[model samples]
Target: MLREIDVVISTNKDLLGLETLINQIKNQSGKFEVSIIIIHQYRRVENLPKFLVDNKILYKNLAEQNLSNAKNEGIKLSRSKIMTFIDDDVSISQDYFLSSWEFLNRNNCDLMFCRINKMNSNLPLSRNMKDNSKKINYFNSSCCLSSSMWINKKENENLYFDKNIGLGAKFGSGDETDFIFSSLSLKKKIYYNSKVSMYHPEEFIGLDNSKQIYSKFFSYGMGQGALYKKHYNKNKFLCIYLYFLSLIKSVLGIFLYLFFFKLKNVIKYFALFYGKIVGFNNYKNIQ
Candidate 1:
């Protein structure tokens, strides 16, 4: 059974916890053809695996685009029917391709959603995933998998990713969310499978209240809000009203954090809240 799949990863040169991950894939035990496409901007990491540099892989140096654009580059280089999106900060415990092969093949699924857990901690992960068993209308872009995922090679030649909408030059957020929603609008089916799992190592302690971080999140919220309003619900007034309410609630969370824990996260909390207050576009302009 030759399950040919292309693995796509977008990363900077500063990935810290990927040594074990690279080793695991190099030593994977499976009967599958796997190709790795990496979009990287840095040249500091030394001693990359032979599999990555010598053969069975494509390397593109992107010094201009954001993560979403890097992902698009990977998609363009991929020749396999199925494309797997893996983060740079993660590793696999088993044969990464084999774990998801049976499930994806049996279903002949266009989109096979994988499960992810936190690394080095007991804290539960959060997923805004659908609960029902039927094919979902949309999904968060955090960890999405696809077979024939890109729109088209020629007609949608510019379909790598919407640079204007996703994480732009500054590690822009919401690329995954934007992609998922856009795909759903085209009436694509996205399915969830628990068998495929990966570890997402958490590193950010708390979100900074800086203009950059807050603005980025606000743009993310706005993108999410627009999606919700356009597809799920058409109540524009309600969406606007809820948007303001969300801002208030975020601000309130800051005071609560300070009052209870006596922690100095005011800057972080306030930046996030203010982003919501000014709206996503306003936040983007500051960037």
Candidate 2:
């Protein structure tokens, strides 16, 4: 009766998506026993699906609207040896759980970053997708996507996401990167594999709202900035190099987009650059 895996999902008002994801997990074919832990935030509990109420799933609600807080809460409640954190809006491949279980045990992995593709398409959700599996390092830690991560709780018992840098938090989006940085600092065995995959909706695929696009990219940039500051003391040289590297890339993107007359992309890069400056300066206040 031992639980082999705990799938932790933090959501806010995405009831339909939650139901779909949970059902998908239930339908997964595997020899492993998996438990579902849902950390719902920022709303009164609604009448959940009968299956959820009748099943042995663990569901909790929080008053605050913080992604990291919700995920941390899930971590505390999880009782399985392996834990997988996934977004509610995503769906897993047919063999997701079995593949992840096999990969973890076969490699003796402490933490794993899996591939994420756009729903109904072969295109990757994150730009960091790799063609092959390999051990993660400080230089390549950017490949750590939170949407489809698998962690061996027995190996990483103390692992937790940073509360200051995720959706609804001040910095607003580098929780996974910060987690990877901490793991690497601890000499944890982290790896990235394309075999274990999930499918998510493509971001801004058909969206026409300029303000929404700007806000999204800006928030992400702020999180990146705060992450650099948070770990600057641990490795000043790396932090400095990454900060400038990001700044340079953003600048180049702005100019390149401008030349191509892609106004939206120009705005996106500009917002990222500006947000980084603001987040870097505001880090002291938050700390």
Candidate 3:
């Protein structure tokens, strides 16, 4: 039987890691048939390994670096009824592929995002809301929704990730959540199942934290601003004002943390708001 679902992996600069990820997929036991498409964003893999070349996986070299661009290409090429986007460095248990299939059926949702588990203890976990409220919740970034999200392709073919945002693009992040937010605006059915999960081990090692923070948060802030401009058009003028106002908000956030004795968040709060300012200024850069 043909595979019922397609897994689109957006990755760059790591063929060995991609090899291991392929192994994990091969090792999975699932009731649903699966096919994969790897969107290599950069650095073409010359002399393909026999394991990957022999498999049913279709490989495409995308010279561009935008994560959203890779995702859009993958979605365009996907031939399954259902599709899920994942990052290359992420790993899932043997049951992950099958579980996502099950989740889509059980929830009967247009889009379903399970959970993303981080590998590091110090890093922090994405918000896990257990309530069954079923209300559309807005996400600050794609932090809560990992690449593990599952979706029905035929039902929402027009709903694609924003090309201007995400990694390798002008905007730092928010492609994942922006898709979710747009779906909500379109009044599409969305479900969140805390039980289903995807694991992404800590990869933020040997990096300069200060520089990383400055650039990443700035882009994220910009993404947020862009999201507002895209979805909340009425708020565009107000967003500009709020962008300037964030300096005050950032200072207040820092003081709030100091009051609560959570001193570490001082920089985090500052980073977040400062990034917002940077994003607000460069909102049109990606849009």
Candidate 4:
């Protein structure tokens, strides 16, 4: 009766509301065993509340500030066949685990996908992710955030989180997407199970008409640039096409805003397009 799934959550100093999130996971009505682990992203462990230590919850306090690095460490510590990542700012429904476990057991795929509810918004991040039972490799359609990803340990042992690309690293974001793309490139099967889900708080990504949004988009570009550098000559057309297409998409959105005399996101889109072009060239020497 060993646990088959490990839900790895990464958090920093902001640990005020984890009790409710942990309660949600504890209440999941799943047949298979699930171990919820929290990795304190900061170097110091003394600040943690006593309840975490007294409850004997499986937790770790590492000095590493990298998000992917902490997750990779979770893989090393997890004693399960499946590893799923969630953020500190998320909660899950009762059926989240059971559905994911059932889907993985039935399909036996290397990767599993579930629904993501923006605990703050009515419309989902993407509408294509239906409640249908199916398998697909959609590169640009879905993001790794809302739909928390599940990884089969046996199939992805050689894959490690790209440390230089996640939060607190060179690129302030794009770590999860990098991990997903890396898994896909390994020829592994990814299954999308629309039933399972988790709740991400209102500001999961801080995406909006704010100045901070530019930094968010910039981090993505830098990370994407590093990815492009890694596979510059590998996918030639497909890779470059995606880069150009992303740039064009943002640039077009900026124009649409200007036409309407609404200048709220003009700088934001420009920053995104600029980040893509800059990210494409910035990491060429490193990877």
Question: Which numbered prediction scores highest in lDDT against the true structure?
Answer: 2
Candidate 1 or 4, higher lDDT? 4
Q: How well does each candidate superpose onto the true structure, as a TM-score?
A: 0.70, 0.94, 0.82, 0.85
Worst 10 residues of 3 by lDDT: 120-129
In model 2, what is the error at residue 251, expressed in angstroms?
2.2
Model 4 C-alpha lDDT per residue in residues 1-287, reported as the tens digit of each score: 55567878888865665777777776778565767788887757755555455343688888878888888888788777877887777677788777777788788777776767677554454555565656655354343452387887665355777888877777655666666677777877777776666666543255665667777767766776666555657677767767777778788979987888756567657766777777778776556
Q: How many angstroms is residue 101 displaced in model 3 relative to the true structure, after the best TM-score fit?
A: 1.6
Residue 124 in candidate 1, Cα distance off native in Å? 3.5
When 3 and 4 are scored with lDDT, the better candidate is 4
Predictions: Cα RMSD each: 5.4, 1.9, 3.8, 3.0
Evaluate model 4: give its lDDT: 0.69
lDDT of candidate 1 over 1-287, digit per residue (tens) = 56677777777764344456556665676866777777775644344655455487676777764766777788778887667777776656675567666666666555566665567543424343223223444323433433213222223333346564454533234455556666555555565655556666542334454554555555555543333333335444644665556567667868887888734445445655654444343434532
List the candidate numbers ranked by TM-score, top first.
2, 4, 3, 1
Any idea what lDDT model 1 has? 0.55
Report how far off residue 41 is in candidate 2 (Å). 1.1
Error of 3 at 27 (Å): 2.0
lDDT of 3 by residue, 1-287 (tens): 54477888877876566887788887887666678898887766555567778566888888888888898998888888888887787767788877767767766777877666675332324544342324345532233464777777546346778888777766667677678877776777777766656677643433356666555666766666565555556445644554456456667878998899864456556766766656656666545
